[model samples]
Target: MTDDAMLTSKHALVTGGGTGIGLAIARALANEGAKVTITGRGQDVLDAVSGAGIHGAAMDVRDEASVNDTVANAISARGPVQICVPNAGIAEGHSVHKTNLSFWRNIMATNLDGAFLTIKACLPGMRDTDWGRVIAISSIAGLRGLPGAAAYSASKHGLIGLIRSLSEEYMGQPYTFNALCPGYVDTPIVDRNQDTIAQRTGMTKENARQLMIDANRHKRLIDADEVAAAALWLVGPGSHSINGQAIQIAGGQTA
Candidate 1:
């Protein structure tokens, strides 16, 4: 798709847009002239970054009533959502034996159930529009197992399944559902995880960081903009042929 053919005069909604990958994707969509609504749990961060064609709303994707109300409000304010990006998630590593039901449910609530509710609420608005894109942000672990992260992996895997089935359901329709499985990205989450890794593996901070970097197989953390570019392509013109695919951004990971 050409620059001019990208999302212009269209409405888009991105969850967890306060920072990291979601913010990058929201900015990219906004740059293409889409009236993008970026949702997050932080009002200050959302307000700090939102401007131009971007609007920020405080939304906790875990709550069904909140998701329903927020989507309704966003649609009423900016028209129907043509592009829905379910990018909000919690990434962490917890041993299965040590993980409790609450821990597991919390992960599922935010990663799996959150994506489910966000897509479900946005579908009505998206279906009403002439064109639509539903992109779920899953992890590379969604495609395979990650040690000590059983719950997280399962949640991401479930998200991919949801997107794939939805894409098939709307195969002939104007809506297209897809998943972006990015490896490690340079985000605040990574910074936090470094501490976790250091504690778990008894490695120095630098060594812990290197461990994740090496895990990417490309031996580098991804830039959030790279993932944003993929989202732009899927919504851009001539991308109708792409659907129901888990587009992995993990560089050459043999895992």
Candidate 2:
């Protein structure tokens, strides 16, 4: 089959698909002829990207009811979700001594719990299909302990653990579970973090941004499309054996 028709008649659901890495992955799947459903907390944000083979649904991944209802609606409208991308998450830096209970919970709720709820809601539909892909957008922090962002790192690490476990649970099945761990991808989250890091460290925004770029071995910020390309590959043909792997999209080796 042609690249454009590879995913024809398939359905994809991507959370936080309004912007950044999520948006990139959603667009790639749509371009491959999948009926894509993009969800986020803001209806306006989702609506802005709806069309051209993509649909929009307003749903908060942190809420179980919202995830359940939104996934059901998407399945009803476009058929089973053969491609599930739980790309909704928040990135924040907080030292353990300064991290309050609410702050840690908030990070887990959005990053870890959000992915769990989204995957859980999408799994039933995926199981009904002969083939399915679960691509969880994790971070480099998931592999290594990121100083000054204990809670954020923990949440991401938890995501990798969840993906690994699910991969074993569905072993021999037609579905695969994997996590994409990227370092400092150019996204709205990174843009916001630049300001936050500058304020926290009393450094210039340029210097703060440079710190992130320096973290990657390549000394440059990664493009969101680079991560999107990996997601597209995971869902494409010949990826059936690539399961339970933490594929790092960082500029180079993280450790």
Candidate 3:
């Protein structure tokens, strides 16, 4: 296949694809000729973004039935989903001492459990195909501690663990499993987090936002398209050997 039609016969499913990085990745895949299904909790948001080869499905990854039904419907409409992006997640900072069970479980349900359910639901169809990719949108916190966000860090860490183990399990198969660990991406999540950080630390919203930017090694927020480029590379030609890896898109060393 040529660069422009690399995914001509493929069907891709992206969770939380209404906006931000997920939307960016979905658009990139659709542009490359993949029939992309963008799923989110809101039908209107997904419908508004749907166009060309892009389709929309309302799905809540936190629920197993929702994941299964959405994936099945997407497969029926666009053929088996050869590309799966478990990109739906929640990011928040809470000191371990102050993090209650509700906060911790909610984070886990959305970030960790959601990835697990999405992958499990999509894998059977992927295995039926000759080419497949599972890209989990993780975070730098998965690689190391994120200070006050202990629960969020642990959920992301678990997500990476799931991807690693799945990669190992299907090592000899055509399928590839990997996680994209990005730091402070320029997304709506960052905007909401600015307010949270400002309230929590008594810093101005601008300072709070800049603090996250400064957290990146290159001292800037990573762009959504940059992460989408990495996803395209992973699913395209010459990436068969790149399995079980946590590719960091943090602009520099995150260790």
Candidate 4:
């Protein structure tokens, strides 16, 4: 089938979809003729940004019951979710030693446990369907040690593990599992993090911004649309052969 034909009847769900990369992906899929559901804890943001068949739902991915219910509700309205993007996560750094129980658990709950539940809840429906995709949004830190972000790195690494294992379990199926590792996307998350970066590095706000810019090998902040495009490609016709892979959208630094 053609790429466009493959995506025409799909239902895609993007977690943390109120804004930033998640919203970008949701809209992109909807544009490609898929029913897209954007989930976030903030109903206001979701409502403000939704359009056409891009629906919004309030969901807290950290809660297991909420994850299950949200997935069930989405399926009830739009049939099975053929594309599941577990993008809801909290990204911040605390040294493993300095990370308290709440801090550590919070990261694990949203990043790791949330991904597990999101994928798990969606799988039964996917198994009943003919084709599906599970794409987890991870980070460059998931592949390597982040000096001050041990907890975040560990959580992301766990997400990667989840995708890898699922890919193996359904090896011969039409479903594929993958991870998107992005570095320093231009988003609200970065805006909130700039202050922390400035305070920690004793640098001006602009300098803190430059630090992240230079971290990307291409010397620019990744556009949210760029990541969305990669996701679109994965769910398209030619990408069925790609599975259990990390498609790094961080210019070249992640390679």
Write the residue-wise lDDT of candidate 2 on 154-190 in tens digits.
Answer: 9999999999999999999999999999999999898
Query: What is the Å distance of residue 185 in model 1 from its true position?
Result: 0.4
All candidates: TM-score: 0.97, 0.98, 0.97, 0.96
Model 3 C-alpha lDDT per residue in residues 190-225, reported as the tens digit of each score:
999999999988999999999999999999999999
Please, what are the lDDT tens digits per residue for candidate 1 over residues 112-161?
A: 99999999998888777678899999989899989999999999999999
Pitting candidate 1 against candidate 3, the one with the higher lDDT is 3
Q: Tell me the tens digit of each residue's lDDT in model 4 across 119-221.
A: 8988888899999999999988788777788899999888888899999999989999999999989999888778898998798889888888888889999
Which residue ranges in model 4 land beyond 4 Å of their true spot?
A: 1-6, 253-255
CA lDDT, every prediction? 0.91, 0.93, 0.93, 0.89
How high is the lDDT of residue 100 in model 4? 98
Model 3 backbone overlap count: 0
The candidate 2 region of ten consecutive residues with least summed lDDT is: 1-10
Candidate 4, residue 49: Cα displacement in angstroms equals: 1.1
Native-referenced Cα lDDT, model 4: 0.89
Mark the 10 consecutive residues where model 3 has the least summed lDDT.
1-10
